[model samples]
Structures are given as structure tokens and as C-alpha cells.
Target: MKVTVIVPARYGSTRFPGKPLANILNKPMIQHVYENVSASTLVDEVIVATDDERIKSVVEGFNGHCFLTSKEHATGTDRIAEVARNLSTDIVVNVQGDEPLISAELIETLIKPFQDDEKLQMATLKSKIKNQEDVTNPNVVKVITNKNNHAVYFSRSTIPYNREKIEVDYFKHIGVYAYRKSFLFDYINLPESILEKAESLEQLRAIENGHSIYVSEVSNELIGVDSPEDIEKVEKFLKAR
Candidate 1:
């Protein structure tokens, strides 16, 4: 199956304007994300979808592929859907531009579910929540999965509320996602669900509509760049490696 990775980058961000162009270890953040996705042996192609000329220029400066998308997109998924609509690939991987630390192995793992289950429409990564602080922090989206490893729900609030005090592992939702090309187009057209709007999470729309999202457990910790402060943390991680 042919797979393509599209990184959505926009110059205007509320938390950190021009974040995709932010420098980390002297290299643009988007470039780091692009290179990481390119390292995936399963990905046949990688493209940067953006609405700004500056971001496109930077991507091309690194000899990376880029496509200009609409500036009116409310979310990265919308931008990716527009690009996926024109592509003929079997699977489209939406790798967030801010995730400079995303591993190629994780991308490979996200796409592997498709090879085994032809019925699977979407998949994403999840990691164990190591601390109580992150579990309670609303900024950290939490997810719970069924016995089959399919996502039961995604919420900002801690789920499966520990009333019984039984030992349970809490998983934080990783933003990277893989979807079938056809499903991407269909998903974009679906009206935003009440749950999705309430949580400000697009993935909830799929869950509300009865579509199953396979959750894959991964060991690597992903640091997504949300603000200028996050750059230092990412830099420290890079320097350690």
C-alpha cells in the first residue's frame, strides 16, 4: 500500500506565531518533522501543507515537498483533508508540524494496523501517563481504550474516574494520526459533533459517529511545540541525543 505523510503548517498560531519556522538546534522545526517522517521506510512520500508563503519557502529551502492550502482552515486536519483529496495514495498520515521529536518508527507503527486489518479506518499513538499532574492537567488530552485496543473516548478530563481505586494505567493521546484516503475525505465532510466541539478535539467526531479509531501503544515520548517555552525542552532533548 502506498502511504504519504503530510505535515500541516501555518504561520499564524495563537500560542506561538510562526511556530513552524521556529528554530531548534539551528534547524527549522518543520524540517525536523519532515525529516523524521521521511525516515519512515514505509512512507512513500512526504509533503508539507501550509497556507503561508514563508513556511512553504522554508520547506522548499530544505528540498522538502510542499503544497499551499487554504488559510481558512480551522484545524490541521482540515488542511490535511484538502491535500488528501487530490492524492491517490492508499493511506495519509497527518504528522503535526510541531512534533519535531516524532519518531519514524512510530509512524511505521501507526500505518502497520492498516496492513493487518483492511477494515480499520483510522489509528493514532498513545503513551502511559507517568505522573498525576499530567493526568489532571486539562491541557493533556487523555484517552481510554477497550479490550481490543480501540479508543473508547478522548477527553480533557480524566476518564474512567478512579472511584473504585483499582489499579489502571492512564494513557495520554498522541496527536499523530493515520487515515485511509477515502475516510479522510468523508471525515472532513461530517458535521462537527457536540462532543468534539465540547472537547475542542476533532477526533471525537469520529468516535461520536461510531467509527472506531485503533489506538497503538508506543514507548517513545513525543514533545509537541505549543509555545516558545517548549523550544527549550525540545532543544534539551535533541542535545541529549
Candidate 2:
């Protein structure tokens, strides 16, 4: 299946305004995200979906493809749906604009499930949570999958409960996803479910609606820049690398 990676960027971040254009070691943040996704072997095209002209100019200056979207979007998924309407690709991957260190290998891994399963409608990545804090933290979304590796539920609370300390793995849901192009409208149009509203994890809508979302286990660490405090760490990491 042909895949197109779309990075939804907006300048009105409550925590960090003009975040997409913020420089990391002199290069813009959106450029870093674009470069990472563009490096993926699985994606055929990469587009930055933004409502601001400043973001459009930054992306265009780097010779990256960008689309101007409506500023009234309530969520990133809705923002990408507009861009998906204009594209003809078989698969659409939503790559977060804040994830400058997002793994290209992980992006490639996300697209792998679609290659063999025609029934798969959506897919996302998960990494093993090593500590009790991350497992319990509401900020870190947890994903529980069925025997066939399809997501059963997604929540902000620790899943499975570890009732007996049995040897089981706890996975934290990564904030990247790939969806079948045909299901874009269906996926977005579905009314917000109780699980989704409660957890604020949109993937729950797919689970609540009885849609199977394949989960790909990956080892790559995702570093996202969400606040001003994270910039120095990212810059230092980038400079060292």
C-alpha cells in the first residue's frame, strides 16, 4: 500500500506558541520532524499540515511539501482528515510535529501490519514501560491488545492491574498512527465515545466502535518537545549526535 506521512502543525499551542518554527540547533522543529519522517523507507510522501502561513513558509523554505488547513480544527486527526481528502494514497500516517526524535524505523514498523492484513483499518506503536511510575502516570497512555495483537482498549490508567505480579508486559502507547485511506472519513466521523472522552485518547474511539487497531511493538525511544524546558535537552542531544 502507498503511504503518505502527514505532520499536523499549529501555532496556537497552549504551552508553546510558534512551536513548529522554534529552532533546535538553528533548524526549525517542524523541519526536524519532516526530516525524520522523510527518511523513512516505508513512506512515499511527506506533507506538513498547518493553518499558519509562517509554518507554510518554513516548510517550503526547506523544500518540503505543506498544506494549508483550516484553523478551526478541534483535533489533529481532524486537521489531517482535510489533508487526506486531497491525497490519493492508500495509507495515511499521522506523524506528530513535536516528535523531532521520532524513529524512522518505527514509522516503517507502523506500515508493516498493513502489508499482510487487508482487514486492518488502523495501526500504532507501543513500547514496553520499564517502571511503575510510567505505568501509573496518567500522562502516559496505556494500551491493551488482544491475542491477535489488535488493540482492545486504551486508557490513561494502568492496565491489567498486575493483580498477582504475573510476568506480563505493560506497554505505553506511542502518539503516532497509520490509518487506511478508505477509513479516514469513517474514523473521524464517528462520534466521540465515552472511553475517548474520558481518557482523551482518540484511539479509544476505534476500540469502542469495534474496529481493530493493530499494535506494533517497537524498541525505539520517542523524544517529543512539549515545553521550553525540553528544548535544551533536544539541542544537546542533536549537537552530540
Candidate 3:
């Protein structure tokens, strides 16, 4: 099946303006994300979907494919769906543009579940929470999965509460997601979910709407740029590599 990776970028971020174009190690953060996603062997095409012309121009400047999406989209998934709707492909991957450290290998890992399970409608990555502090950190979204590896729930609060002190492990949610092109449309049509709104997480909508999301556990910890401070963290990682 053909897989396309779409990175949704917007210049207007309430926390950090022009975040997509933020500089990281001398290259635009979007450029770093685009180039890495392009390196994924499973991806047949890689494109940037943005509402800003400035973002579009920069993407083209780097010789990357970019599509200008509607500014009305409230979420990054919506921005990606606008571009995916016109593409003739089987699967669409939404890789956050802010994650300059996202590796091609991780992208490949996220796509593997679909190859193994044709029935999987949506999939995303997660990593075992190694640090005790991370388990309680609300900023670090945690996810729990069932025996089938399907996500049971995503929450800002620590899950599996361990009220009885069992051997349960916590997993921090990775933002990258893969969706069957048909399911992508289905998701957008579903009404805004209570859980989604409460947690400020888009993935919760699928769960609330009675759809399953496969959560693949990966080892790599990718730093997603949410604010200016994160750029320094990314630069340090990149420089060391």
C-alpha cells in the first residue's frame, strides 16, 4: 500500500508564533522534519500541509512538496486531512512538523503495524515511561493498551492508577499517527468528543466514537518542539548526533 507522510505546519501558534519556521541548528524546523520523513523507506510521498504562505514558501525553498490548506482548520489533523483528501493513496501519516528529531526509523516503526494488520484503521507510537517523574508529569500524556495492543485510553493524568501497586508500566504517548485514508475522513466527520476536549488530545475522539487506535511501543524518545525552549533541547540532541 502507498503511504504518504504529511507534516502540518502553521505560523500561528498561541504559545510560539511562527513555530514551523523556527530555526534549529541553522535549518528551519519544518525542513528538518520534512527531510527526515522523506528518508523513511515506507513513505511513498512526503509533503508539508500548511495554511500560511510563508510556511509554504519555505517548504518549496527546500525543494519539498507542500500544499496550502484552509486556514479554518482548528487542529493539525484537520490540516493534514485537507491535503490527504486530494491524494490517491492507501495510508496517510501525520508527522508533527515541530519534531525535528523524529527519525526515519521511528516513522517506519509506526507504519509497520498497518502492514501486519490490514484491518487497523489508525495507529500511533508510544514509549515506556522510564522515569518515575514522567509517570506523574501531566505534560507527558500517558496511554494504556489492551491485550490486543489497541489503545484503551489517553490521558494527562497517570493511568492504570496502580491503586493496588501492581506491575503495570506507564507509556508516554508519541504524537505521530498513521490512518487509513478512508478512516481519516470518518474521523473528521465524527463530532467533537468529550474526552478529546477534556484532554485536549485529538486521538481521544476516535476512541469516543467507537473506533480503535493501535498503539505501537517504540524505544526512541523524540523531542517535539512546543515552545522556544524546546528548540535548544533539539539543537543539543542534533549537535551530539
Which candidate number would show the highest TM-score if scored against the true structure?
A: 1
lDDT of 1 by residue, 179-237 (tens): 99988888888999999999999999999999999999998998899999999999999
Badly placed stretches (over 4 Å) of model 1 are none
Residue-pair clashes per prediction, in order, are: 0, 0, 0
Tens digits of per-residue lDDT for model 2, 39-96: 9888899999999999999999999999999999989999999999978899999988
Weakest lDDT window of 10 consecutive positions for candidate 3: 160-169
Q: What does the lDDT read for residue 177 in candidate 3?
A: 95
Residues 1-241 of candidate 3: C-alpha lDDT, one tens digit per residue: 9999999988998999999999987899999999998998899999999989999999999999999889899898999999998899999999988889888999998899999999999999899999999999999999999999999999999997898888888999999999999999999989999999999988999999899999888999888888899989988987888
**Candidate 3, residue 174: lDDT:** 94
Q: What RMSD does each model have against the real structure? A: 0.7, 1.2, 1.0
**TM match of model 2 to true structure:** 0.96
lDDT to native, each model: 0.94, 0.90, 0.92
- Misplaced by over 4 Å in model 3 are none
